[model samples]
Target: MDQITNDLKKSLESNDAYCLSELSTLFSDRALTDGPHINEDLNTCYGGVLNELHNVACLNGNEVWTSGDKDNIYLYNLKGDILKDFQTSSTSCIQDIAVTQSGQLLYTDDNNRSVNIVSNTQIDTLIKLNEWIPHGVCIASSGDFLVAMTSVDWDHTNVVRYSGSTEKYSIQWDDQGQPLFPAGYTTKYLKENKNLDICLADPDARAVMVVSAARKLRFKYTGSSSSITLKEPFYPSGITTDNYSKILIADMCNQIIHIVDKNSHFLRYIKNYNLRSPRGLRVDSKDNLFVAECYTGRIKKIQFYR
Candidate 1:
């Protein structure tokens, strides 16, 4: 694993892929957990992975990890066995979670009020809200953190970066620096591309906006019909870019996973009638897709080839 990640970094340095500054931030030293595993224990909870999975990450000994509307994060081994069950002490439901390059877990609740760190033993509050609400959290390859936030007062939303657990940069409705959207924008999800770029799923704007490794707008990619536009299925809820450079979008309304090229070419849709309100989606090292069934409280595992 070290050799592979190092090779990826060297390739970035050599411009083999994109510069390290442009790809997603997966630091050189931090690894949450390793390998892929199935999670059969979840089957009883939602009738055989019914496909409403909310959030999934790699942690503990499992190749797969996930969290639901409930206040628990699950770590499952590669074979789909449950490992550690990290509970939130209190009955707070976590909406999204991001694993840093340092193997640190950071997340926010559905209400987007505070941020917490999930460890082997305890859950600690990293940041608190006197008024503002924090929505999503992401980790840069260099170990920095990017978070999506919103205002408690209005429809305003923004993104910010932090050093470790401290605020380093913030974006608001100021003429000085506006994020991918203005005040009305709501950033639901955030992830780092292989090139270290930050990809955000903004359902309101109905697009996937890209911020460079340096946190600058690289581009915004929407789906295509005859010419390349984000039309009906444009309401992107959950998003992830796979190893094949395909963007997998969870069209919550459409009940399918839409795959497009980096340039937003309409590839193919992974549609299954069973998926319901898939608010979160993730890909394991093996390229198998794990979806979080948001409403029904289920996690669906779809094998790419199978």
Candidate 2:
């Protein structure tokens, strides 16, 4: 343990990019805690400004960016006040939205087949694909962009990694040469776990698929039948991970959030919060979860961990 700490300190002092997965492994014992339990509700931001809220991205500790079936994105505070409203470069609605570590907003425009970044009200096109339509996007700890895309014909789907508009690689198949994600125009949301695992919520498959940093198949969580409160089919819509590497998935059909460990072990279900069609999820630095309700058009703030 001392040696590992010394090595991490040296890497930090040198200002070089370090592997978060290695750190997570080294500190797994210390990071592990009791099962997560929900605390009192913190706040709720009314998203009625949008016709139907679909996605929510944490901008900072006190602010979040929201989008619906429109080309505009609104930034709101915990008090439900709009801080700023920005429109996408294309007239199409935003498929998904994510915030970078540096606080910049990134969104996907499937209609234009482009990925754009919003900085100080100026929208710049970062990536433009020919046959693939961008659906969901998230920023990895390595400063790379992981985008979920569907083919032009909507028959195939995959996740691609990009570094400043340059294609790095893609994760589409498993070791057995089978497609990892379901096909068609289904909504697929993804995020990078603290262990450097790519976690995706696929509603069509009704499962949460996770892949290691090496792009190997880790596990697939297809909802638990033991839970009496969870509805019949598990419909995972949005996904996010906390500092402890716990995967939080939004179950759209059940109207609850499912919590799982890094190894795909079912932890618990958050069903007490008056969740109504929880579609998108985002966790702040403090593990505060922000859930976007599709029908209610509201963003609820939840504290599920100490």
Candidate 3:
């Protein structure tokens, strides 16, 4: 508590990018970290969710698919039963997951060595990393493939799109020959909707940068603080989209999740649970919430209210 805050303060003062990145994300979720489901008391303030998970994904049904630290991939029913525990390759760790538009399976690892394409055939590929480490992957509404990329050490991040047989690496915004995030940020998610590839950028600059699927910069949200200054953390991660065309971001460091409308208005928040660290938010066809609990290593399901 106090120790973590003080440590964070010191780290921020020195401009340690990783710690700063962590802090920025922490404050963004502070709005809900103290909800009853999170702290059990309004006065007892804290940040983050109540669970842990290595990775998480939502299926067409209310079910959730997750990987625990125990070297097992489990498909869970709503009642939390192990419906299936399909053993993956011994050393293949699950990092990111994306389902097809028709509800099939696709996932990528941090190493970018493989992309799992699921079916009865269970096809998968370890895409050789020629330039960057893979952070997130998604199938756009139009069925294009988009991969979120970053330097191995998290120095630079970008979104690259593959449509049909043509591939384009994005510059600043999504156009070719444009400069990607100049500050060298790590982009965690690419969400496609309404024929647009939406990039949710989580840069070390402590803000959310939005860009088109083609990698064009749309807008940037550094996030606002209720306090007088922007000292609160704002490392935005685990991005998902809602029905009304809003974006949901997991403010990891603060233990809260924020919902921003398509117009980017700060909407209501979900602070009902204590999160150690939440990342990789996913909304199913029904708009149910699923998140990867980074620190404790468990994936917990969240019910959404309109």
Candidate 4:
């Protein structure tokens, strides 16, 4: 039995496909846990250094990259001190921002029709699009990044995966041949769940769409019908997933953060800490949620999980 186990291990390690499949299943076994009875407010960092806090990307411990309706992106610590600031290559406003596992900063330049990376304070065009204008971006666990883009005419929208600068595939339509995402220039935030599910927060559709890693339609979570406080229509903007595979989405119009399970089950609502027009959501390695309030220009850090 020992020899057989060793042989099996060697075989798995030798095959990348088997190793990745096993690793994915191993991680998915960890189920989501119920959050704390009352979430704690950690700190509030002023992102008003920009015009408006549009998005946030977790860089490392207690540090995050923030962007607004401008070409410049600022890096700030939780203490509200600006660590670094860099401007995009294009003069137009940045659509979204994300940080790679290696701590590299990436942002979408819709006007330039490209995705760029910031290295050593220099901007490098990583992926250039001819027909689609990139908006939202997120780095997957596999190091591949996903970009949500709309066509030049703003008549079509989809999420495309890229391995470095090479296009792997795209998730555009459902099994029924219907569009997976709504068309338009509306912002669509993308994040990969622990279960390898591609979750997108589409504000134009007024729904949070979750698809399998293979691009299969898993589920769509509209707002909770039973909630009394959610008087406005569901307008999901920024999206993120925690260590427990729990998904959190920012509802800008309602000023609430909705938490859902990997299966799209409504878990709870985070409406504390005076979340005024929360537009971007990001969770750190420690499970601390950093919310970017658009109009307020503030980033609120909260410990929602116990």
lDDT on C-alpha atoms for all candidate structures:
0.63, 0.81, 0.57, 0.80
- lDDT string for model 1 (1-306, tens) is 547666766665432244353223343322212232333324413222333346776543245567665566777665556666777754555767877665667778636377888676577888776666776676655577777876777467777777856987665433455545545435478776665666778787777776655545767766445633333566788887655555678877667667765544676666554777666777666566777766675566666542
Query: What local lDDT score does residue 305 receive in model 2, on the 0 to 100 scale?
Result: 61
Candidate 2, after superposition: displacement of residue 78 in Å?
A: 1.0
Which candidate would rank higher by TM-score, 1 or 4? 4
TM-score of 4: 0.86
Q: Kindly list the per-residue Cα lDDT of model 3 for residues 184-267, writing each as its tens digit.
A: 534466565432436464636666666643344557766674532323577776677754456778877776677776555676
lDDT of 4 by residue, 219-247 (tens): 99988756555879999988999877788
What TM-score fits each model?
0.73, 0.87, 0.70, 0.86
Best by lDDT: 2
* Model 2 lDDT per residue over 147-214, tens place: 99889888888999999889988999988999988886787899988777889888878888888877
Where is model 3 more than 4 Å wrong at Cα? 1-52, 68-72, 89-92, 152-155, 163-178, 182-187, 195-197, 213-215, 225-232, 296-300
RMSD of 2: 4.3
Error of 3 at 211 (Å): 0.9
For model 1, the local distance difference test gives 0.63
Candidate 3 local Cα displacement, residue 296, angstroms: 4.4
